[model samples]
Target: MVEADARIRLYEPSDDKLVKFSIGKASMEGLAVANQSACFHPFTLSAWVALSCIMIQLLDWWPKPEYGLLGYLPPLPAFGCWGAVMLYLIDWFNRPQFEDASMDLLRRPDVADIAKHYQRSPSSGFFILEYSGKFVGLIAIDASKDSQSQDTLMDKKKLSSSLPAKKSQGTSSVATIRHFYIDEPYRKAGIQEDLLAHAVQHAFKADSAVKEIKATTTSLIAYSQKCIRDAGFALEKPLGKLGVYGWKLDLVVLRRAYWEKQAAGTVL
Candidate 1:
């Protein structure tokens, strides 16, 4: 194992170069590849639609040959729509997802603005894991107040009914984990477990009102779910094909209580 002193710290604008390098490495590993479907993928479906429209426009304009209203009109709308759709699909596929959160972060044009967004409040912040003075991982947490956060909450309630009940006193503040990633070479070294533990501790410390930390991951990334579990979170239900997991601070307290009780009995 590569034994190096590792530390997790708040993100800084100066860390952009290390962050970008990490993203580039991930992209090369094909971790950012779009999910492919046997049946037409969404991008492929879009391309087909655009192509069909172009063909229809060509067929309509072919016989006319002259630069009249009909010939010009069909080509204009057809090519416009096709170009727009193609551009959209290109961007969509190119954008990284959860597995490559660091890449997604680096891709943003306004890194400073993004850094500010996460650091806007004590309850939210972005973090990077540095091992041996080299950044190797990153994770972020933010308050769940936006539309995406609301949607995730809704999914959790609807799908994770069977998950362990909250043992801690409930609060309105919910923190969502974002852009969690660890370098491949350094993984399986219990780094993720440590990172997650720190994340929860930081969340509780930063905002005492935060009672719960919520995370979601696709079934495809089994290691992510494992990391969450190793950090003392419980797997809830499946939200669509994604698995939902949560850690309640109250549960930690309860577990601690149980251990204390056992220790007291041993002393007696």
Candidate 2:
């Protein structure tokens, strides 16, 4: 049983290639979302063409003795503006996909950076699901403060205080699940559920102060949302059309209380 369990386990430094492939797959999905929603802008294309022509003209003139440095001046603004517009378009293409979210930790360009991130933060964890020694899926958990407002937290505190004493000690920290992905061939095999459970367990083990586990997904990704919901999370909020799901770890406190009570009884 231990040997079988070892196949699906936490990510190691040697699994860099697998981690890169998973992140690339997730990035491609984000790019696909951009491509689908992309709009045609004739003016933007025309501006780019116009700037290119001016830059070419300036370069041609710069070789002439009379033009000299004066030729360079004419193209500087055009070049700068063109570069800015190109960057804007690139960002615009990707912005709608992420909706200005903070998943940058998962979308890192370098897999080594991601590995370094997990190594630096003892409170963070990454897990992979493997079959026959080949990695097939991946997920990660990150520590963060609750995004809820102070007033909302206060309200929650008041409500919890009214509950039985065993359940009143709520935690303020949160663990967020990110970059969850499964290979196409491995889909629909219940691997994602196991990966999620492993991620949550790893998070709780890594940071006992974490009071909740949260995840966010777009409605378009029905399977992803279903996997989260099936793993005992519930919809906590709606970000436009996107859904934020969370699982409160109140049971963590209750379980500790029960264990302490048993210890006290034994002592008595």
Candidate 3:
């Protein structure tokens, strides 16, 4: 009887243990509202569907033919702005570096909640990830029109004093890689890689308009550099005094199409 019980225990693996954290699509609707913040964007399928219908109809019904496609599209700039919003939201949610225990000790849930609410109003859409059904880590991208221009996106005060300016504005929207972290035990696994994979994949699948996905990171964590590289990001030459000084999460820049193309190549 004891042997039989031991055999059964062997067959049944523990449930709470961390399993594979692979890259998967997040259902923006299932995102826990409490975790919403400027860094995390969550949208339901129904809301997305409704927004799409309204935008498509409005775009198809423009009165003036002079602007061509732009004229036909919805005059509501907010409605037309979702692509960039979704991109940043996902990026923020998957930011694993932000989830350090020291940072969490300083961060309060109430503050995070308030921030999330402001970020998820009808005008925006945020993206995030789920670990064991908990909002363990997240990445958010805001598509608001009032964002800063390239010359001053990452102020020196925020990071190393010597980093160079990394900015581009071919379009009106900007993509911010807002948040990233892995839960305690999950960090030991390859959750970071999975998170990055999903983020780049979603950026590519979401819109054709996305030109680049930008982020910052410290010189530390050689793994992070590798992760960005595996995802197809190229490192810019070190910035002036910034290279001499060290900081956490030095600002890094990556493109969606580049990583997506490489990811797709592997599947083939």
Candidate 4:
């Protein structure tokens, strides 16, 4: 449980080491989550079942009476069953997914410098949630390069504006939330939602031109949809199949006007 001392504060230079460690830890955790969340995509299961049936059908057809009621050969059916089991094991316990996911986290810039890319933009910042003296989790948001542009109506906004969108935000003064992770032990505390709320609330209030926020999460993360939904983000679209295992990236959006209209008093 998160202690009463738990609080979300601005990121400090001293926290860099722990933040890196957490990101690495999250890579391993992400792999575990990906492995367990396979149920979310049932097609994978159906395919495995179909393969097993095919293997059984082949075994029954290949064996002859002289071959001991097995395929034409004495040990052919045994070999077929063994081969099928091995394939299932190899597919189910794949390590490529973990390797790919880990390398990506290690490459992300924020795991170390906080919002270094922002170049100290006040409207953007990294936050760490601390329980007692230990860091429980962290979330960061960065404004697009067009952050300073004049406020304009949503209908009037155009991609041709002189300023390009921050890669994280990808157009206009939008702020993209990144590296939002909580240590496993502390997730049961329900503090994740509050941490997310503070980040979003701060982003909207920090700048007026920043009328919308975008976040890239994964279909592999089962709880992500509900958590971000509770925070006022709606699934805008699917990014695509991202890894070798066919996992997907989803884009979710939260509009400033919508955030202001939430009925939940506890939502920041």
Candidate 5:
């Protein structure tokens, strides 16, 4: 009984020390909570293998001709557009959906609507950016075959140059980037730069003789402008209005520099 009483007394909380004892217990609880926190995702082995295959295929495309009708098709545009919608939803959940949001303010009604339309029409040339098996962003290219302005832009060099007649009449191999968006958290982690570097490298591997890859971005996209510039794309001109509504649509032209002075390359 005496030993039991002594042990009980030793373990008992005294009134005078109760506050300090509670604090110690709380500190331990806080540490326990912290230790239970989750970690950021890392890429898996299967993902790495899939990525390797994609890299091989992308590089292998360089030397071959882009087959007609199928070559330039943006795979699974519906899925890509939905992926973009998911990204926007993530953004909205984290931040306020401002009334003057760029999508709302621009020609598009809203980001979700724009994404839905693209999914249905499938011409926006959008692709999802997945990192560590998570959706990180979206990349889009403007490759509408009927875009006269883009066609004119691509053809301007050949039409205006005084180079050899054969070179002038040959192929006009070029492509334009239209949209690129990364989630806010993923913006500064060099993912954007890495993606572009990989993309450009893949393009080069596809065709050693392919010359250029260009893109246009609005000055309003300040963050994107910096990203594009950092990726070795240079600004060319301010884009004028889109249509006769005289609705002023201003954008900056960005071009990627490539040297392909070979005769085997054909333009799309």
Candidate 6:
């Protein structure tokens, strides 16, 4: 069984290629799946249907022979602003994902440098979940993001620091889940769930000041949101929308007090 071979451990410099392959593939696939999921929303579908009907209507405006011959297609680019509207709409939807520096940190040989971001704070770390000696998934924590949500959105600006951009300014103690991804084949085995558990424990164990752990998920990823909810995080607030589709992301917080209470009053 895949479960028998499952192991969750810290990331290593040597895992570069495997990390890149898994992260990029899974990240892109997740993005595609999430996009498809968002398109299924009633509003999105209705808008798409309306657009299609408009396009079909426009096709009738195509030049037709005096005999009303078949196969007469319109000069699409010449027709009104539909072409420009589609181009601008696609651009608007695409910019957010590519411009998001934090997301870029998740995909590459560049991502290998993630350890540098965590090294200054023992309370933070990057973790890997391996199955049968192969890297299959990963998760990261950042002490720097204590007072704010993880910077998972794309702004027009590039990455200004090795650390994520949304770190809060304060004396409060919190840890943020910076990145988390598990490949599809290994997702439901429960071993993958331990990755989150391990990360949360490590954050609390490494820093007594860390009174809470927080993560964010978009409405597009209902399964991921459900998993985080089951892990004890409660919705904190709706941050904002992303892309032309307006997928909503929310902050969720899990307090250290709950952990100690669950343990019958033991400190982390």
The per-model lDDT (C-alpha) reads: 0.55, 0.56, 0.41, 0.66, 0.39, 0.65
* Model 2 agreement with the true structure over 1-268: per-residue lDDT tens digits: 4454425676777887768766656645644443333323454556676776778686662333467766456555665777677656755656554543324433332233556445434456677888877778888765533222222233445767564523112333666665788877777777777777667666666657766666766534446667776655656656553211111211111122332343356523
Taking the tens digit of each residue's C-alpha lDDT, what string does model 6 give over 97-116? 73453357553322546656
**Collision pairs in model 5:** 61-206, 62-205, 62-206, 62-207, 63-206
The best candidate by TM-score is: 6
The digit string of per-residue lDDT tens for model 5 on 1-268 reads: 3331100011112221432232233223322222122111132233434554465465553222367666544433433444455445434442232222322223221122334322321222345556654455555443222211332222435565653323111112454454465656777776776555544454444443334556655433445667777665665556653211122234433333322322234312
**Which segments of candidate 3 are over 4 A away from where they belong?**
1-125, 146-174, 221-225, 237-249, 266-268
Clashes of 4: 4
Please give each candidate's TM-score: 0.50, 0.50, 0.40, 0.66, 0.36, 0.67
Write model 3 residue lDDT over 1-268, tens digit each, in one string.
Answer: 3331100010012211221121111221112221233223234334544676677666674345697767654545544466456445544553432333224322322113324422432222234445544544444343323222222222334644565433222322344444444444555655667777666555445555556666544333344455666566666444421111112344566665566567567623
For residue 262, give model 2's deviation from the true position in Å.
Answer: 21
User: How far off is residue 39 in model 3, in Å?
Assistant: 33
TM match of model 5 to true structure: 0.36
User: Candidate 1 on 1-268: residue-level lDDT in tens?
Assistant: 9776878888888887776566455433332323323113555666666685767666774335486666546555565666666556644554434334444445442242447556545767678999899877987766434302332333445656775533222233667675577887778776887787677667666666666667765434445557875555555555542111111111111122332343356523
Off by over 4 Å in 6: 1-4, 20-30, 43-95, 98-112, 144-172, 265-268
Model 2 deviation from the true structure expressed as Cα RMSD, one decimal place: 15.0
The alpha-carbon lDDT assigned to residue 144 of candidate 6 equals 55
